[model samples]
Target: MTYILQLVTAGLAVGSVYALIAIGIVLIYKCSGVVNFAQGAFVMMGAYLTFAASRLGLPPVLAVTLALVLMAGIGVLAERVVLRPMLKAPVVAVMMVTLGMLIMIRASCLAVWGPDPLAFPRIFPDGALELFGVFITYNYLTAGVLSILLSLGFLGFYRFTAVGLMQRCAADNPRAALAIGIHTSNQVSLAWAMSAGLAGVGGTLLATLNGLSLGLADIGLIAFPVIVLGGLTSLGGALVAGLLLGLLQSFTDGLLSPMIEDLLRAHTRIYSVGALQQVVPYALLVAVLLLRPQGIFGRKGSERL
Candidate 1:
């Protein structure tokens, strides 16, 4: 029971980070209709930026803040420079541009930070809290709590604030928004900025959990299965799917992998199931796509071109 609880706690922590990053992907998709493949790049950059700032003697909080602000600015700039110009281009072109942006960001990071993984500074205190036989570290708790808070806050903003209303209007119908005098272009840019900032936070939290590395960007790819499972247009779906994927991956990593390996070992020549956790999401994604393409909590016909 303790072991199961431990695994659950760990999964929740990691899953929260996935949910946060997934939300960013959904935000960009909803606002601009372009799938931003560079989200992983943004995540990678945030971790590196946090690392750089920490090395410069900034506290972890400050370092994270600096990274978030910088990433938000980068997102705004990206909208202006890349997305804005390509507004008239095909959706395929915008996607390709985002992919190209990912490569460029990765190359730049490699040139500056090199290809080595660095130990991220610990923002939370060491050791775990014992509660009813379950042990959870401060890091996990912090990540989970912060992810929830940020998600709820963003949801509230979308529901109440004027800017958020404008964003929703634009997302719901760009032509209607423009016809009604809402600055759809500016709203789109704001969406990019907000999405990038959220991605930065997601990246920073992930780094704290898994350490800083170029591979961090790959989290964006992992997010693809998550959003697909949750539905492309539903914010609530993203949150649920992110958490579900995270927990599924964690449980697979902790319990299922070993069990499968043991069964294979006894029956076959295979000695290991390398990175089984990574495969789970894609499998789930395929199943979701095949069975219910609308996704959990997603509306039918939401996949607009």
Candidate 2:
């Protein structure tokens, strides 16, 4: 029971990060009809920026705020300079541009930060807590709570504001939105900014949990499986799917991997499952594609968010 509780807490923490990133992905897809492959790079940049800010003697709150603000500016610049000009191009071409942007952003980070991992700044109080027999650290708890709140807050904003109404219109039909004086380009830019900012926050939480490193960029790919599972057009679905995936991965690692490994060891000579936890998302992805390609929350006839 203790072990199970531990996995649940840890899963929620990691899943929160996944949900945040996936939410960003969904936003871009909705607004621009183009997946910003650079979403992961934005996450990486956020963490690195935080580190740089800390080195510059900023406090945690200030550093994070500065990082997110800078990321938003970067997002706007990316849209205006790189993506805006390509608006008339094919969707695939625009996606490729984002891919290029991802490479460039990553290269810039590598050039600046070097390849070694950095110890992330301590944002929460030190020590751990035992909650009903489950142990959780202050860092994990803080990250989990903050991420969940941010995600829910974003949802509330998306669902209950006039800006959200405009956003929906822009996403539903950019051409029609433009004809109706909606400034779809501005909507697209706003989406990028919000997405990048959310990813920055998520990245900081993840770096606190997993340490800061270039490998953080790879963690961004985890959002793909999440969006696919939740339905490409459904932001709420992405949040749910991200948490579900985190739980799935946690159980796979904590329970299934050990049980399977024990069985294999007893019956044959096999000793490991080749990162079984890591494979669960793709495995689920295959099942999802075969059975429900539109995702659980995705509408069948329309691609509306």
Alpha-carbon TM-score of each model against the true structure:
0.97, 0.96
How much is 61 displaced in model 1, in angstroms?
1.6
Model 1 lDDT, full chain set: 0.90
Task: Please report, as a residue range, the 10-residue window in candidate 2 with the lowest summed lDDT.
Answer: 296-305
| Candidate number of the best TM-score | 1
Candidate lDDT scores, in order, read 0.90, 0.89
Q: Worst ten-residue run, lDDT, model 1?
A: 296-305
Which residue ranges in model 1 land beyond 4 Å of their true spot?
none
Local accuracy of candidate 2 as per-residue lDDT tens digits, 1-305: 88899999999988988999999999988887878888899999999999899999999999999999999999889988998888789878987898898889899999999999999988788899999999999998898889888989998888999788889899998779889889888888999899999988888888999999988887667888899899998999999999999999999999999999999999999999978989999998888877888888887753422
Off by over 4 Å in 2: 301-305
RMSD of 2: 1.7
Angstrom error of the Cα, residue 136, model 2: value is 0.9
